[model samples]
Target: MRQLTLDLQPAAPPSLENYVSGSNGEALTALAAWLAPDNREPLFFLWGESGAGKSHLLQACAATCSDARLDPQLASLPTSSGLWAVDHLEALADGGQVVLFNLINRLRASDGRLLLAARLPPRLLELREDLRTRLGSGLVYRLRSLSDEEKRAALAELARARGLELSPAVIDYLFARVPRDMRSLTQLLRAIDQFSLEHKRPISLPLLREVLQTSPPT
Candidate 1:
């Protein structure tokens, strides 16, 4: 077994490139259109189901905010490069609306941008009229869950990126024995990596089965 130490710190952040391009649709393209300076909106409302790559999109935007070539409009910050992410904005839309309103106003005055994500769309959030209107002003995109094939492909790429050799049989085992989705697959890969390291052995079907049988799913 290779004794390479997995840089767990670096692994903490999921790969954004995989998330954006592999979202099972042209949603990322639509998002790219919205990010264009001319097409850029002061407010952007993104909503989707859990594990639908919402965070990935937001992080990708934030990660590349400094790259003028990617988004020239994203050049200025605090004034123009402002980024706000709210996971459960719907739950606190009413109270949070005022704060967001002020922030948006300030960003506008300074020529900035705002990005927000939630599980539900703004109209259904039941917030203040003005806030609701503001949120509705920008373009909104809904993210859908990945199909089984998409999830498997994503898992394979994730495994490769992590320097793990996940055979087809192991992939099938995981898909059948565990929750068949990107999020769960990712967690399982991490667990397998850890188990392999601790046991000083390569990842195998028997070890994965044992791990699944003992560990609770996240």
Candidate 2:
């Protein structure tokens, strides 16, 4: 018999320190406290639109704990210690809903913590009433997207982290030409960094245009 093997690429590890709080400082603070080892809350639900960094925060929380589980498929809840960080709660099937509902009940009786992320709030999710109510029982947060200025600041911070000194004019140039989102901006910044490294050149307007024109928009 032949054994089947599957190759999977590990996702980049996320950390609370790498996250740019922007306008969501309060939300960040609350999440940091909830993710702390000493948090008393048994459950937390975080809602945000696409690209609002819910996944990043969830993964970050999971990374902080040794026994944490992140993005586990909900056919049934696995018995695990420490925090359980579940993403895409809105897509849970009927069986998953029942399992989560029961898991929440079990966690309520123990020291384990739950962190859930979804595109919509529990009241609006297509889930069992009991499960939805349980999910909403603890602290609920709505993650806000960063503003344009905040995005620029985040890009500048990222550039600095990469040891690239970007001037105000260069920042403004990238902001005007690149997609006005953190994900896209960060990807573009990386591309620029790679291009500069390959060409042995400094990041300037000419190099920025060369990279932008040659590469597809992120």
Candidate 3:
């Protein structure tokens, strides 16, 4: 019997380079600039639909900063220098809203950077009016979803990074049959890669079929 071994450690840290900017080049550029030591912007807000790479960008930014917070709860804001990448800002509770509002003021005073992501713009978030206005005070960008061709390219790039040699035909097949969202697509690709490695077989159409048949749907 062949036992499957699952590598449970966290996946490699997300980086800015691995992110497919696609049509969100401007937003990507802004994020890169904000990471610089001398960026004048104290806050940046990013909003988009789910699976639009908001969390990926936030994590990438957090990886570069020594002191950073992701989706911070009601924790006390650090007074030291660092960036704060808050994902799903809309989900913050009333207490979180107050905390974030105060944090924004402190960051402004210290010239610290804050990056926030949400499904809707700051105006749409059910937060304090002052907090909403504060969020809008800085650079705001809407992350765009990748097009079909861009998604295909991204998938191919991801496969290459994972040392998987997926042919164009296989890529197309996955595109047609699998979920179009990158998060789901990447998860499926990882599953297929694991299955192939366990079976000691190269990734191919047949292998992919087997993996898909065995794996539960997303």
The model with the greatest lDDT is 3
lDDT of 3 at 5: 25
Give the TM-score (vs. native) of candidate 2.
0.80
Candidate 2's C-alpha runs over 4 A off are: 1-12, 63-73, 213-218
lDDT of 3 by residue, 121-174 (tens): 989877889999999999899998898999998888898999887799999889
Best first by lDDT, ranked? 3, 2, 1
lDDT of each: 0.66, 0.76, 0.77
Tens digits of per-residue lDDT for model 1 on 7-36? 332344554455635554676777776667
Cα error, residue 49 of model 3, in Å, equals 0.4
Clash count per candidate: 4, 0, 0
Write down the lDDT that model 3 would get. 0.77
Best by TM-score: 2
| Model 1 error, position 82 (Å) | 2.6
Candidate ranking (TM-score, best to worst): 2, 3, 1
TM-scores across all candidates?
0.68, 0.80, 0.79
